[model samples]
Target chain A: MSIASHALWVACLGLPALAADRIEGPGLGSPVSAQSVAARNTSIYPDGRGLPEGRGSAGDGRLVYQQKCASCHGERGEGGSGGHLVGRGPLTGSDADKAVGNYWPSATTLFAFTRRAMPMDAPGSLSADDTYAVTAFLLYLNGIVGADEALDARSLPAVRMPNRDGFVWIDAVQPEKPR
Target chain B: MPPVNPSCRAIARCVQSGGAVRAFSVVLDCADTMISPDTQREHSAAVAAQEALSMERWSRSRLNADDQAPVAGGGLLDRRLFLKRGLVFSGAGALAWSSGAAGADQAALPSLRVPGRGFSNYGQPSEQEKRAIRWISANRAVPGNGVSWSPLHALEGIITPSGLHFERHHNGVPDIRIDAHRLLIHGMVERALTFSLADLARYPMRSQMLFVECGGNSNSGWNKEPLQSRAGYLHGLASCSEWAGVPLAVVLDEAGIDPAAKWLIAEGADAAAIHISIPLKKAMDDCMLALYQNGERIRPENGYPLRLIVPGWEGILSIKWLQRLEVAAEPVMARNETAKYTELLPSGKSRMFTFVMDAKSVITSPSPGDTLRSHGLYEVRGLAWSGRGRIRRVDVSADAGKTWAPAQLQEPVLPMCFTRFRIPWNWRGETAVLKSRAIDESGYVQPERDKLVAERGRNGYFHYNAIAAWQVDEDGEVTHVYR
Candidate 1:
């Protein structure tokens, strides 16, 4: 049989056996409460569907950084074991290993990253307000925002990154050299 | 399962659960009477103690020094003398102590179970195999400007575990959020278009089992002294996997590629914003916007949400965290293409864009560290692959390059994938060399070490496909050498 046909056959044979096994066998009980599981399953979409109701100011973010983040990220956000969050030089041409604040093209990515995986240990532990605060603080450190600037969902998307235009799509058929 | 005597069973099971051999007093008694004076003289105290109960006794008086003969036909000593084996059996006390020690060792071994933890949403490699990780050898100054080699020696089967796949990063691994990741296609296209990961997922997708090898792999082969490392460490940067994604043509069609546009510049989301210009024909032909690897979403170390998969091309071109594609009229002449990946030829000129990895083969088993026990029938096994096409043949040389024999190539030798080959070899006591050479479908044969050096010149650091030779001495020591 051809590889694809064999794979199909295996899948056909395996699915029923798996279904039967699951029905007949004792299953591992759900660990989390149903309501909590439902809440955790919420996924944010690109068209701004699942955005939470919260606002943060760059001034408030500076206080949050000093209180919680600065111990590891350094006072100026130059980074230590946690990585620098500010003062990025050139985003694309030649030297690219500066900092995330200047290089990242999307402010939405900053908020999303902080909301999902930050503080080294406890991932997904930050509130939406806290995530926005951290994003504002990081942007301020990169000289993208004023110390007292308020950052909300609308303002966050408008904050343009230095390397916003640095990237180009992968055109496989083209022969033009990279800029 | 009980362990049966290998000679008595039709099919011997090498792996057994318990000690099943019974102590035979009669066999032990017979073994004691068969040792010869010459045997005693040849075997030192340690060897004699180990063989006391097992070996056959020989008479010193009948054994002449000049003409030694076989015990069974009229060629050697008396048949009865050979039959009488040695019986210098170990005491019951010692046997009991040995068994007790064995039991203690078994008890000390850790159990493969968790105390409280249970199932996981995602799986990871076993803790015992943690050392089987990609050896990251990045530039010290730059956080992500370097390469990580796949631990090929520690892996089995064709698919490289996603976590251990090699990485060649121009910038650090970007923490890309799935929601924010957008692929933009602009420039010479009829209409500038942007695609979210969900939008790309809506398109029809195909999966391929292939290998991605860094062009600069085995560049150390140009070194004056042979590097002392495992075969995988020397050539582990290459890996094979099943990549699944949407066809590049579908996306290019959506963007409406203009006829004048010949080159496509691919850029990443990382800090470096690394870019590479590829031919438009190659992209529209077989390229893919890969989203899944090995039946799951691509790992963070790999291209998480999306990556450009250039089949059979250099790994660097398979840009991860793909962000943009700008259709252009001419080549971009990226830094990667000009400063790096360019091979300085023996002549003054240099060879650039040498993308496809040529045919290569290496013996993985019976390699450097593994040993052959008792010099009997042994199977020599290894893997061979080619980027140009399928591996047509793998020739194994046991007696150095003196004799070449075809090895059994495992079935389903897919193009641009690893093909396993094995051969049975009877290893005698004489010193010998082992090597393997692969010939691709295009009839491109792997060159010998000397031939490769002669053609490429001493300064050549890339595209090294020299035949690897392993020397085995009388004492069973295997070492790598240029033959």
Candidate 2:
């Protein structure tokens, strides 16, 4: 926040307002080892900034999806009580089957999400190889990827999503009105 | 068999029975004077004769007719009528003195003979009050990913009881040991640092009453028809509390920003590790790493130890059980922001990051599922709030939108907090439509359901802050309705 707003914030708390923004603290935070940072960094950016090193293809991922995801998400990502992960429904319709193919805008999200929380029953249980393979398998099922084409951290980020440019950021206080 | 004024109905029964009636009575609830303001304890023949004479006298002389007169369309009366003195119900409450049923149910105190139970280390609501609970609705396959609605209809005032606050879980709450829990702040910063729960508590903190509303709150209002449910079930996804915490600005300034950082990827420790990309600007604003809720160390369900408070923003952005903050130059396009929270319009385009819950209000008492057995005098109470600033005025409409009157707002109306509003209503056994609309200091008026849908198409499912309407039948049964 700007210094003026910061001053107002402090004043609202019934505290004396500070004329200038303080750039220093007691520095109570403790530093961590590189390994500790790596263990904690679970976020994967939109541009594939944190994709783990692993290589896999649709051919190698079919078995992984069947074993870990089929029980809830169905054998072909068609769904079995769980939300369908593969669908191409119209976004303008009420029953918009928003899934990977028609809704998800990034491919790295698949790996980032799988590595952090997937398989419902066992989150964080997938290895980098398993995550990459499962991501590729879902992508192939959605027709965004080929069967034999191997995908690693380098090539995965380059695979463009079908709805990459479909989203629009809104910061206005008003909602959209039809003409 | 048509609905009739309870008092007049009783008078008609008394006149039909030519002989001295057994016992003349009034609706017990309508009689705040205990057993029907002018009723005798004994149901003897002599007392019955005297009661019959009084009923005939009451029928001849209309009581409190001026006070019960409608100020606006329907039965709305002056908002201050409740606070004013005197004005006995007279002919207001449901004349429940059935010419059939005899004695008063609680004329004698049965609990006086039995000793009350001793107090405990922690107290709970009485067995009778246990009905006021969070109604859980989750996915059939993944029970963890669901919502539990608060019982707003069963509550009064503004502050939602901590235990009764609504909850939305992505993959269930995780059991985190405080000592082991660490908040990792990395990425674009001069120094990457970690703060334990103890470390965070030592910082200076401030308390403020603010509401956190889910983006998907009131999404059901976008349905083809009005949902027949309690007010909270439809809109209780939003809740207010007196939150105490260290400002996120303090922590961010201490870490030293890299200047290039534009976004912060906040992730929770739950099994879903549910993450969202927030703009750095909001972090520097009113955001706080909340350490306490409602003057307590927060509940296990409400992110104990630490939860981020993003004042007035969507509830999902609050990030409960918060664990990490990855500062970067761009957003991660998390599933929540891109595919879920985003609104799809009829034009085939979608709008994402529609933050800030606009002005909204709803009548809790006499809402759907509540029946008004008494007709004399009633108080219409409800909650009103806005994300922008303090609530300036809340107008209530009893005959759809035909007419409206300003409700009396509860005192100490703070910004971004729940402000209680109430108005006096004198129901005369007439069918009426009830509704309330909030106006924030920012000059934003809560839209009607039709105008809202006209602007934002049916495909737009989130951020629905439209006026809610309730229909009261002549028989006093209130039900949810669109008109």
Candidate 3:
């Protein structure tokens, strides 16, 4: 018997055959709850979409930074074992210290990064308010924000960074090089 | 996983006391030995001669007349040599067997004198091969935050043993429990969903042999001076494996992906919680939630329970220890993408999200730190790969691109996987500069170091895929050079 004819016969006989035009896959995933996703959905977007309700000033952040992030990041964010969080330098030079104010194009990144992966040894341990406070302190250290400015979900993303227009996306239309 | 005693500082070291460096001495205990004193010297010499002669002759005879002829200036044999035709092994084997019989003492080894050691549940490499290891280059204060390079110089063929696969960890490796782990595919979808390991197994699964290379794999190549280290340390931040898992598109399709979701914010569960942004278009094309490596469960360091295998892209795109994948419209512009992975050009503008690894090749056999032993005839072996596609050709030059030779591409050279290439060369004790350039199916050629550096500028450290040059000194030592 021909393979196609055999498959047809098998289908006529009510035997299961591979579906050719079926686009939707074998649904196996279980629907996740809001509470469960909230626990893992710590992704903070560039437009400050995932920022939670939190408020802190540089003064509030100084205590949090010294207590939790100082051992590795040094006393004043000048950097030690951890990378320098303060100071701005040329991106092309040998000593391009990619501190908070100089390199990062978005202010929301500081909150997201610090909230998700800061303190080196202990990550995601800081409270939302503490994380916002630390973000403010680091921004202040890099001269992006004032020492007493209270940063929250509303005001954090609004703060313009020094190197906001520093980065350029891949321009494919331009002439190609060896890179 | 088999126990790898990596803590041993000095591997393959012999205990030398009172000027005695011999491994096996003439044993007076004849009752426990296989050979007696009278014929020991004769037996030893005969054995050595028979073994060496047979090997040289047998290897030489395997080649047909067409294979014997050199295709290029460096005595490069035809790539067709790999596709050996006709029944020629018996003739060579007969000759080898007769020669060995003449020196009958060449038969049994000391190991065959007694029963061998029992089997292991998971077998490790021979104790004598302990020299092979991933060379760790971690920071003193933060050991786990650095990379341990795969010892590509000490290995052969294509597939890097899973244990020795290169590791580039932003933070330390996280100990994730299989039962507790969940892959949440949420955000910008019609219905948010999370799949457990068991749930994922029910979906259609397939495996592909792909390479995962760090964007910073050859970052050192950006330096003014070529690094003087093993070929692995210089370019070992990449690794290949038969990654088996469900297609990522299947899961996304089940979740009913939103049309506006153009990006994926992949976050790992490690201490770094490494947040990375990948294009949604690429994710749907050929990404996989890799559950297995080399037919076994993935190693903990290489992302055990679940990881994304972004084919033909940088290793960082393949998020290890994956926890949450948030579908979105824009990139997260995380630390890695902004502060680190971005390249600073001469124009003072930094280039971001440059993903594809370009075509590149390195002669692994006679690479740096390898001393070409007598150097009459040698197989110039190396690995060539292109993240864009399969390598179309790899031309080797022994005299600094003055003369070129085509190498035999080992069979089953899959796309985005390491394609092993080899060519026979006759080195007449002359100082030579060795070079290998890869041309991918996409027609992308590996650029020279000078051309690459000149175009990339001094500060662009990531995505370096330049042709590697190895200088063969007259003394038989090989070192890296920028030619």
Candidate 4:
């Protein structure tokens, strides 16, 4: 018999075949508690969804940036060891020159990335306020906002990135879509 | 697996130390003693002739016309004489040394007297093959965030040994206890569910040979100058293995994905908590929660208990130490997808989520760091692959791109897996350049270096899949060059 027909025959014999059209057999696992997901699943999307209530100004952020990020990102955010936080145009350049100011396409990414993973050494340690402060400081260094401008859940999403419209969602274009 | 015998180790050492002829002769002599006199007489003359042929001086440049004959396809070599095909064992012609001394005086060999040790629970490559290891390039400052390259040039066959599979870890590999680990599926799902490793194992499974390649693989090609390194080091960030797992779609269906869930935000348990957004369609199609690789439990460095395997997608999207997958309406804009992996297109705009790796091929043997010992005939062997689909053809050029020759594709060239292609070429002491370009089933040709550079520019350094060229000096030294 042909392989396809043999597979069909096997399926008919009540024997488990390789990959089913849909799920078969008893569904595995148990329902998870909503609290557990709420506690750990802390990811923020681009449209300001899942953001916590907090506020910080660029001036207030300078202190946090100095204490927590300066060691790696440089005191002035010019970048010493870790990636640069300030630069302009041509996101592609020397490793030190591809700063957040130039390359990053979304401002919300800064707040999300900072809140989730930042400080290089002690990630997930920053408070929501501290994360906002750092995000404001980075934006200030990029000249995206004034030093006194306050950034919060309502204000952060409105910040425009220099390269915000520069990106191309490659999945939607060119070569015939995924089969 | 049983303990490997010390004698077996000794035999391996003997074979590895250019004493294969002597070791094989001793083994044959021992066999001769056990066989009856009539049988020995029947094979004695044939064995003697084989031994004589083995001891005969041979040149690397010499090739039998019958074996090197060109086939019907453009520049394609005859497939009958492929060294990897139709492996057969003959008594007299035993221990075939494809191209090496066959016979030597076998007087002193310890393995002849001592019986080897028993097997062990797990096996390892013989001590002599220790050279086959992942070339690690980790950061001294960060320690764990780095990459290890698979030694592709040293390996044979299409399947890369699980131990030697390339690695690109963001945070040091997490020591996740299988029993303690639980994968949480929540967010836009109708029901939030957490499954233990055992629970996932209860589901139906499928195994397929697929390749996982880091998005940054072959970035060295973007360097202003071509890098001089082994073929594996330059492009070894990709590896192929047989992964066995439960289709992710089934698990998602169990969770009942919300129609609004357009993306799946996968997070790892690593210190970095590396997370990225994968399209919901891709997740529901052909993606799997891989629990095993190469017929065994996945290696610790390669996502121990569970990993999300998105076939043909960037390796990073195949998150290791998978902890939670949150269905979302859009991308998380994670650091990996923004500051890194994203490319700065020459159009002055950045390109994000350029997920699929394009068609590419590399001549593994006679590559940089390999020297042509003699001017005789050599089989130009290499691997060709395309994230889009199976490689339809791999055209190899011996004298740069002036002329092209088709290579014989090995059987079972599955989609998105490494297809070993080879063509025999005769070198006559001339300084020749070698190149191979892969054409996938979609008719997408691997771009040339100049064409790629002209389009992408040298400022960006990701997803570089241009044709690689190796130059052979008159003295037989091979090195990398951007032609």
Candidate 5:
């Protein structure tokens, strides 16, 4: 059978009218409609490519961060059960805790990761505005931006990370160069 | 009803070939003809001669510390001699049964005269084999965040039985209802697409026998002192299995990947929302959207319905319960790539996206917690593997690093899969240190513990592929040691 027709037949099996195929549907996973793609496209890129159109300040982000993120990531972002968000220590050479303020390379990644997966218990549950505000709050906690500074797609990508140039992409397949 | 016995089936087929009476007569005549005097005498004589020959071989093969014939160019015995007795290397290899030819040792045990339990739709390892289990190590504060180690030393073959495969979790395994699970392929694409588990199953599929090793495997090796736990508990983060699924390349091609897309940010559906950035080259090269593991629908902990199996890559990159693939020009630089899984090199610079595992081997049989038990003639067996390619050779050093002897690699040493290697050793009661080093197909040799430490420095905590050493004491106790 053609691939397109096969995809449709497989999807049609999920419908109720297909009485004989109902039991077999469990073995075959439920079909995903084409419309489902729009909702699932939630990842944000390093260049602020997939960020949703929204804006928020550190003041607004504080309430969202406390209500959602604070329990896992400590009250002051000092790291309790989750990762520490605010640390000025070195990123490498010594065993310094890699926190967002020092280790992260991109600020847009903060919004993308938190929006898609955050609060640890409930992921993709925060509103777009809440995600932007939380990203601003985390930046403020890290002393990268002011507490009252507003952030959106344009501003979040412009913020620089402390260890932006620390990472070096060494080829995993290559042997250690004769140092 | 009990499953049909092969012997009974054979008898039934014989009866069908001829009438029951004729079959009975044929059996009697065959037995009578075989027992005839002349034939009996000749058979007995031939048996006697064969037994004598085997007896001579038995005496020669018998364990004797002083009487071993030296191998050419080495003090150790010829490696071929180790395969003479029960070292059958087919499908899981031989069990090393130290008994008479007819298994007289087991004959002493009573047989069950009555019928036992009936068969079930599903099966489990015999209750007597309860020792094979994943040893769990979790964060006390967050029970969800933890890892369960596969009991590698207890298992026999290359394939890690699904139940005992190692598990690494950021947030505990989510009970995903397969019907609700959807995979999204978006970002730099001509057409963003969503596929259900059923849709993926309809696509063309492929199976590969490969190992998924956690990047942090052998992390204990980075410790200043050697860990004293069993082999599996220390370095069992890796497990091999036959993963069958649709190729991610086909899925991405269907979604129409943009020319500019160089990275794919794959994310899992777990509460932790664990995601990692995979290079497009690796994804298009040999990545699979895995649906079944070991010929069955994957278990919940293993990301049932769908997972990404990037052969020879770190385990985290092969995301479990994969939900989304965001094609992008650059990596996501997510917390996983930045905060964790990255290595701190001695040059004070950090190494990111170090995916492939290095060549390494460990003597699991003689590892810590396994007693030597007055070892006379023992098959020193272990596992060796390399991510670059197939294993070329494995060398065992009995006196620490003083001398080295080659071990026999089991047949079908596929790339990135576990290669079981065995060498026969005669252990007198004297104390000795044991080590095994592996060389991959690419001519890369596994470095010694000291050499690896000197190069990577103490700041390193991941990708420790140094040769592991075990110390055998005079009292027959085996312990982990850095020789």
Candidate 6:
């Protein structure tokens, strides 16, 4: 059956018997503009594109972390209700607390996470500057960056995580049999 | 009538004359309570007069019964004993009422008869079964950013009643108006296309029974001490249903996915605006754009109107309130992927995108909070499933992990749906531990607790499928403990 007819049938099942409604008419009364929605979801590639235009310093991040994040995350990023942000020790074999400095595989992930859903209460409330500052503070807490070092999209991706070389990809070559 | 004992004779005489005698006054007392005050005297007299007649008949019946008596289990009686329907009197002085006169007496009692009410558009379960509800464990500060466990123990049958399905909300559920909802396909597509709910509904549809499990389920197992909870409370974040919708492949084809597109960023329309990056290969392979669940439109708690149903993956990736699908060259590495769903490892590395829920099984009955109640022959029942494939066998060990026996799996074990398993267990008095392990069709046997810890490290939190143990004491109390 045509996709249109199938959709019509589902609609008939979901709603009271109404006459066939045309798919076209004022963009089906959608609230948001198609162009704006598309623009909002810019693609962030692994090789590094779609990074937002902003920069921040670890020294600046210290002020931002104290003002916005320290209440739940603790002063030294030891973690409280929110999780610990700093690494405990080495990033090789077992016995590591694998937090910011040690565990995270990519610095891009840290930037995306903080930008989208951090600070718990007021998510997306922070400006790009504030997000970069917070990211820098977390990196500094994990001992990845100097206290005064600035972080931007280009520089952020280059900051190698301590545990970067520790991981071994699932050996698909000889798939492990179920035990 | 035959001569009665002297004690009975005195009481019978008092009763026959309607005298105020307490002993041997059963007939008179019954008549007094049943009849009105004005007719009580007459009723008592009538019953008293009938008692002498009944006594004469009883003597004749005794003679007839004595003459026709046979040995035990004789006179049309078989050697096999039949279960009795009515109450059995075991104590002395207990009376057994026969059908004819006893039934008539019972029917004469006053009773109120009222007709009950009728049907509704939507039906609720019986009022007595209201305890079957999702136990909400939401974040106190956030309105709806927590998990609610499906009450699996309270439910019977495979399908989780739509109302009580477990919920894991990152943000509060949004009341999105269906008429206003539209899905925009953009990014690395040849042609950017936007489809309304009406337009999407027009696509060819397919239905399959599948389960969605949250990746971080059973994280409590990572704790130093074994957490005490009903099996469902700990692992109830997963549920199975018959999801029907358009194949996502068709949509991707229509949008003309660019050859360079490797990842698809799926975004939701909630206040959190949750987004996640999914590989293009998986999305085009078995993923479904689900509109209906279990033969009905999806419940609001589950993505109403539309959702992406990715088979054999964690529930979070199945974005609800689907607003847009942006094809891309690489993963967005959203917050869920980076910080939240990622698990910190002891080796100073984090495990990201750990999607599949491995094979796991737990004995539902005779579990914690239930007593064995002098166990003799008891049924051990549990649920088992695997995201990789269908469950092949479930081995239940009653003596901890020492000995194992094959369990009976219910038929039609569809891939990725809950398959119920049962086995007959005869329990002796000694304290014992019970464990069940599921082996999927892919030859993946569930890992033991110690083995899991060794492989995944103590600090790892997600995808915990360690064999769970329930210790049964001599007192018949079952408790969760590591054996």
**Candidate number of the best TM-score:** 2
Question: How does each model score on TM-score?
Answer: 0.58, 0.83, 0.83, 0.83, 0.79, 0.74
Candidate 1 Cα misplacement greater than 4 A, ranges: A1-179, B1-117
Query: Which regions of candidate 4 are displaced past 4 Å?
Result: A1-19, A91-97, A173-179, B1-62, B65-102
Docking class of 6: incorrect
Model 6, range B165-244, lDDT digits (tens) per residue? 77777767879899988788888876777778887777667898887888766665655555545566556887778899
- Candidate 3 per-residue lDDT over residues B1-483, each given as its tens digit: 322222111111111111111111101111012222323334333322322211243233333333366666555556655455762434644565566653576556666687888978998898767557776644334556667777777778889889989988867889999988889988899888988888887777889998889887866676556655668767898888899998888888888889977888888888888878888988887899999999999999999899999998888889999878889877877878877777877666778888888888888877776666553556788999999999999999988887788888887899999999987676667898889999999999899888887787756667889889999899877877888
Off by over 4 Å in 3: A1-24, A93-97, A171-179, B1-105
- TM-score of chain A by itself in each prediction: 0.66, 0.80, 0.78, 0.78, 0.73, 0.70
Single out the weakest 10-residue window by summed lDDT for candidate 2 chain A: A170-179
Candidate 4: RMSD over Cα atoms? 13.7
- The alpha-carbon deviation from the true structure for residue A93 of candidate 4, after best TM-score superposition, in angstroms, is 8.8
Q: Model 6, stretches more than 4 Å misplaced?
A: A1-38, A91-95, A171-179, B1-112, B343-350
Per-residue lDDT tens digits for candidate 4, residues A1-179, read 34467567778887764525555524776887878888887887666777899899899899999899887566787543344577876654343235678778778888887877676577789998989888998899888999999988888888877776667778733223211
TM-score of the first chain of model 5:
0.73
Among these predictions, the greatest DockQ belongs to: 2
Q: Is the docking of candidate 3 incorrect, acceptable, medium or high quality?
A: acceptable
- Any runs in candidate 2 off by more than 4 Å, and if so which? A1-26, A172-179, B1-69, B85-114
| lDDT, residue B360, model 6 | 84
Kindly report the docking quality category of candidate 5. incorrect
Fraction of the reference Cα-Cα interface contacts (below 8 Å) that each candidate reproduces? 0.01, 0.53, 0.55, 0.52, 0.39, 0.19
User: Which portions of model 5 show Cα errors greater than 4 Å?
Assistant: A1-36, A57-67, A92-94, A172-179, B1-62, B70-77, B85-111
What is candidate 6's TM-score for chain A? 0.70
What's the lDDT for residue A134 in model 1?
76
On the 0 to 100 scale, the lDDT of residue B379 in model 6 is 55
Q: What's the lDDT for all of these models?
A: 0.62, 0.74, 0.74, 0.74, 0.72, 0.66
State model 6's lDDT.
0.66
Clashing pairs in 2: B27-B96, B92-B376, B93-B376, B94-B375
Deviation in angstroms for B241 in model 3? 0.4
